[model samples]
Target: MLKIGPIFNYLQDMADKDASRMEMSIPQLMEKGYTWVLHRYHLSMIRYPKLDEALSIRTWHSPYKNLYSLRAFEMTTSFGEVLAKATTSWIIINYSTKRPMRLDRHVTSQYYKEIIPFEFDFSSLSPLERIDLEDIYPVRIRDLDINNHVNNAVYVEWAAETVPTNILQSMRPSEIDVIFKEQLTYGEKAVVQTQKEKTASNVFDHVILRESDAREITRIRTSWKNMPL
Candidate 1:
């Protein structure tokens, strides 16, 4: 019962562990009133690994700019079969002041820089259309991170909740690209607008907005494939 949810959760976990050992750990950053915030996440899956499969993930990092860094992960089976590729972009900001922090060269230099990263192009995704599915998701206490905002990774679940039940039952999402636009607090509710288009693939595009003013929250485009395992 592997789901896309775990794809991100596990990847984030591994990144934290590896970074901690290299001195860029989350705990260390929080002490300075600075923490990384995920702005983009893109994942492409060649196949889903079974529960019994023994998999390994190799990660590459790049310091994209003075304020932001990029990381990519390649998931593979023990036998060398590639399962998926994931890339994310993050920025460090002081939560209290809500200002972006300058890059710490000492930290960025620790990760190997040669691994190529998959670039995300938002313009290529289908434009937002009439809402086919709209729902309100409550922000749970557990979803809040040290930043006191909803964890960016949980936004995937909010978007996935709007997927049509029929599609969820028949297809598995093989690709996902998301952009985080706004932050949500504990009592706030996320109103999601989702549309499914038929082309070469069933492309689902979602526009998550704040209920109060209809301000954009997040944008996600997901493409699904038949269960090919």
Candidate 2:
């Protein structure tokens, strides 16, 4: 079955392809001294495909607003059976200053589209009130992506590492919502903290912090379902 980490990579890849189609790919934006960064994601899975299962993925962007842009993705089987869907928010930042820039300042309105496959509230994710489990993972060179920072998908893996073994073995993530707060790079270590939601045993909240200064870098919430027999 597909795992959250790979699924995230697929979503990001599709988004990149769409951006390339608009002449806004990462390399293209970097040449203009700007790079798009993912801010938030809300992904729900209807089913995870088996290994070697053929799949089709589609992604499109919505109208840009102020400093942010919206993108949505859908994954399906050969017959168009919906397997997963996601909505993401992103912002373009000046590569040199590392600060967000107005979308219109760089990207023209011509690239914006009104087609939205789905909607997800991008409200701030709440902080974890308590930690039920914690673990530490050292950043490795292999974890870095093209931007030279820890890949967004690595944060999801770090958070999952803190989940209880029983839950990891018995349940599959049905939905995952994440907010990226800061960038992590090689030679750093992440402190992952996880807490099971009191109201829903199958739901978990996670926070990933930089071990050097205890700075929170990411927040995630995952809803899980029992594995099918």
Candidate 3:
């Protein structure tokens, strides 16, 4: 029996959701001369299901080109309400050269047999207005990854915490994208500021900064839907 919390913990949830499906394993793909790297992802938790809830996930490749892979997923609870849904963009890299490559026909056929298009229009709530709040979190030793910089997951964790719980519980995240502009080394301080979009109901924009030096490290835009957007 797969327990929910441990495997579905903050960071692992994003990864395990992808690993449980798919015809070919990541390692297998690497051996076959391709590597998959996550470009961006959006996660929304609408009522985190109980521990014993029997859940099922289905993933399909919507389409792809040399630069990116468009994959979609549907997650349902045992009682059958869609718990989580997301589309991920992945890039196939040449392991030796570390450059992106065009997706192969054989690989596309293996993952997706038919193409169905779906767009939630989450962008309508993006690029929020400028209202400012200060968020400071100490960069812990554990936050440091092998690259000697703060891990990307930490940014998401901080942003999620800063978002109001009522808004988060009522709305699911329709889309989220972030760009890493700089690095935050261990023992360095980090700060975050979030603002809402004047044009949209639940759009939030955030900036992560290095508190010690006041250098911006990342920028994030998040959009939410009362129902699925």
Candidate 4:
């Protein structure tokens, strides 16, 4: 139901917005060349949109400072139903030192002028459980990236491939929150561990690990919805 390209575009646009806010607070300092670098990001999508649906996004900086800046985003349908929510963690880094810098007073005050409040208890997110999932297809040489490691984005591609064929064709993964725990060296085989939880609905948790050592490489949580197949 979600359009992959557009969702990616939205993420980029939001990044730009966050950057612009940062720039406004310290034009001179920012102009002198210090900037922020993302350290972690997490996205949780509940439902995907049907074709031609208009949506709105709202974001605000949370309370964390310096070593971590918490930004939360919510996407909603035209009728105001919430579609997805995501959180990103960032750090201020000295370009020259390549080390993280404390968020000076000015930057913090500027962004959190109107902080939005939300309750998120990550402790209950459910541990990395296991389930029976389809085997990962072969990883080709081309699948490797410039770092001599598997590309982070490739995890999304692989997870999408493992969805049921019928589900794969009809719905797009509206939201995915991925955590990169480690890197995969060249030719490292990956095994996917998955779990499905249901109360009123089904939620999925998947972990990708090195096939040989069984070390976790990354975890991806994807949410799906129904549309005409």
Candidate with maximal lDDT: 2
Score every model by TM-score: 0.88, 0.94, 0.61, 0.61
The C-alpha stretches of model 1 lying farther than 4 A from their native spots are 104-127, 198-200
Candidate structures ordered by lDDT, highest first: 2, 1, 4, 3
Model 1, residue pairs in steric clash: none
Q: Could you give me the TM-score of model 3 versus the true structure?
A: 0.61
Per-residue error at 33 for model 2, in Å?
1.3
Sort the predicted structures by TM-score, highest score first: 2, 1, 4, 3
lDDT at 197, model 3: 68
Expressed as tens digits, the lDDT of each residue in 158-194 for candidate 2 is 8877778888888888888999888899999999999
Q: After superposition, how far is residue 61 of candidate 4 from its true place, in Å?
A: 1.1
RMSD for each model, in Å, please?
2.5, 1.7, 5.9, 5.5
Q: What local lDDT score does residue 201 receive in model 4, on the 0 to 100 scale? A: 39
lDDT of 3 by residue, 72-111 (tens): 6667876689866666566666666756777663254545
Give the local distance difference test score of model 4: 0.63
Residue 157 lDDT in model 2?
Answer: 83
Per residue, candidate 1 scores C-alpha lDDT tens digits across 59-129 of: 76676766667888889999999999988888877768867787754355555434355564433555586
